[model samples]
Every structure is written in C-alpha cells, then in structure tokens.
Target: MRSRSLFSLLTLVGLAALLLTACGGGGSKKKASSSSSGQAGGTLITVAKGAPSGSPDPQINYTLQEWQILIISHDGLLAFKRTSGTEGTKLVPDLATAIPKPQDGGKTYVFHIRKGIKFSDGKELKPSDVKYTFERLFKIGQSPNAGTWYNVIVGGDACVKTPSTCDLSKGVVADDAAGTVTFHL
Candidate 1:
C-alpha cells in the first residue's frame, strides 16, 4: 500500500513537471526568435555561461563547448560526420584525400593532405602545419587529454615530461613536397 501511494505521488510530480515544461511560464523577458532566409547577417545570442573556460586555442581548449565551436571552424585529417544518431559517429576524411590503411602492423598512418584547401587567412594548408599543430599541442601541455589521447605518438612520453623542449619529429613526419603527413605510433 505504501509503494502504491509513493508511485502515485511520483506520477503526480512527473505530470506537474511535464505541464510546467510545456507552459514555460515565469519571466516577462521576450524570448529571441529567428527565421531562416538562407542569408547571413543576423545575431545569434547564446547564453552559455562557464563553458569553454580557457582561450579558443585548439591545442589548449579541451572542453566540449569549445569542441562544438571549433569543429565548425576547423578541419582535421579525419573527423566524425556531423549528423544525427549513429551516422554522426562515423569517421570521415576531412583534410586527407582518403583514409589511409594502417601500415607497419597498425603502428603507422600516412595521410595525403588535400590540395587547394585554404585557411581563413587565405594561406594554403600544408602537411607541415599538421606536424606543427601536434607538436604545439604537446609543447603547450595544457589540454586535459593530451597525454591520454596523444601519448600513443612516438616521442610523446618525453613531451609529456618536458613540454618546453617537446619534439615530435619521429612521431609526426611531414613531407611538404609530397603533401603527406605520416604518424608513427
């Protein structure tokens, strides 16, 4: 009998919550609304307080909020599909021409950099930038998951220890002429 009474109380509370959520009544502040016109020049005011705590540097920022913004602005060798449900989880080539098959017993991966892609500043993207980016990530040593996720690269352990002199030459090799960046794990 006690369990039945408790269940009834829970059901009432759940219904109340659902009704309140549906009503959304409280403040008199008018909510901002937007319409799609397939054009730019509009204000997008997001009230996200306390997210993306640090600067917007890709190597240093590790929060989910930062990633959400960064993913839209940046492209990596590979990236997950930006879709809903299971399709979004699939990895696809972003800057690389195609995903290279793992070589040397799954210890090495060679990515052929996509040609003609330019940065926001109109600078051509190069394979050397990929190498430099990873090296900078280690050198900074501020990203939360750098050690856990990037330590698999060669010479990463030393970088984790001494960030000032972090070197990933053996780990990340960039051939500018060939337009390729190779990673040795």
Candidate 2:
C-alpha cells in the first residue's frame, strides 16, 4: 500500500513539472522565431551580472569575461586553431598572410601583412600599426602579461621601465613598401 502511494505521488509531481514546462514559454516564441529565421543579422546579446573590472580597451582588458566577447571581433598575426583536442594548439595565420620562417637564429621573425585590410574607420591597415601596437602595449603599463609574454622583444625591458618615451626602433621594424613587420628579440 505504501509503495503504491509513493508511485502515485511521483506521477502527480512529474505531471505538474511537465505542465509547468509546457506553459513556461509565455511570449518568447515569436521573438525567438523572428531572430532565428534571418530577420536579424544573427545578433548576440550578452548580459553580465556585474560591470567589467577594468577599461574596455582590448589591449587593456585581460578579464576572461570581456575576452569572450572581444575575441569574436579581434584578430592577431597568428591565432590558435579553433579545433578540439591537441590540433587546437596549432598556430594559424590571421591578419598575417602566413607565418614567416624565423631568422637570426630564431631571435627574429617577419610577418607579411594581408593586403586590403581596413579598420572600422576605413583607414588602411599598415604594417607600421603593428609596430605601434606593441609600443602602446608596454607604454600602457596596465597589461599584466606585458613582462611575462612580450618581454622577449628587444626593447621590451626598456619600454616597461619608462613607457612614455618607449622606442622600439631596434626591436620592431616595419617596412611599408614591403608590407612586413619584423620583430627582433
């Protein structure tokens, strides 16, 4: 008799849960259908429980939450392959046409920038901008990974110390005509 009663109670609870779930979609069906059926440009909306900890600048923001959104829009000279397992660790060209062979006993690398790339402002992307960005990275002084990750650059040590006057002429060489940015460690 007790076992039968328990089964009856469980059946009632299961029915109640099913009914509530069926009624859960009050009005979201229409909105979801319109957005998914190509009415909108596949827009993604992200909601965070709290505000970001630091500046929204991609170079400045190192938080994982911000990076989840930033990674979708940003590109680098090389990026890890977006695959599962060990294959994901492989380097793939992004803004760069191809990964160049290291020169100077693996202490120097030259990357050929892809042609016809433009910024949001319609300004042409130049190789010199690549050099400028690294300088800015050290000059900002807020990047936590600057010393650990980029300190191998020739002038990175000096740039980390006195950022305002940081010059990486010897460390980074950008050739506008050749469309290359060379880094010397």
Best by lDDT: 1
Once superposed on the true structure, which residue ranges of model 1 sit more than 4 Å away at CA? 1-52
Q: Candidate 2 local accuracy as lDDT? A: 0.63
Worst 10-residue lDDT window for candidate 2 reads 16-25
Q: lDDT for model 1, please.
A: 0.65
Local distance difference test, each candidate: 0.65, 0.63
Residues 36-63, candidate 2, lDDT per residue (tens digit)? 4455477777656476577766556666
Report the lDDT tens digits of candidate 1 across residue range 1-185.
54443333222212111111111113344775686655678887464656447876756655677666655556666666779999986656667777677677666778897787766455787788778777777787685655876676799889999988999999889999999988787
**Candidate 2 Cα misplacement greater than 4 A, ranges:** 1-49
RMSD of each: 17.0, 20.0
TM-scores for candidates 1 onward, in order: 0.72, 0.72
Mark the 10 consecutive residues where model 1 has the least summed lDDT: 16-25
Task: Tell me the lDDT of model 2 at 116.
Answer: 72
Q: In candidate 1, residue 96 scores what lDDT?
A: 73
Error of model 2, residue 36, in angstroms: 15
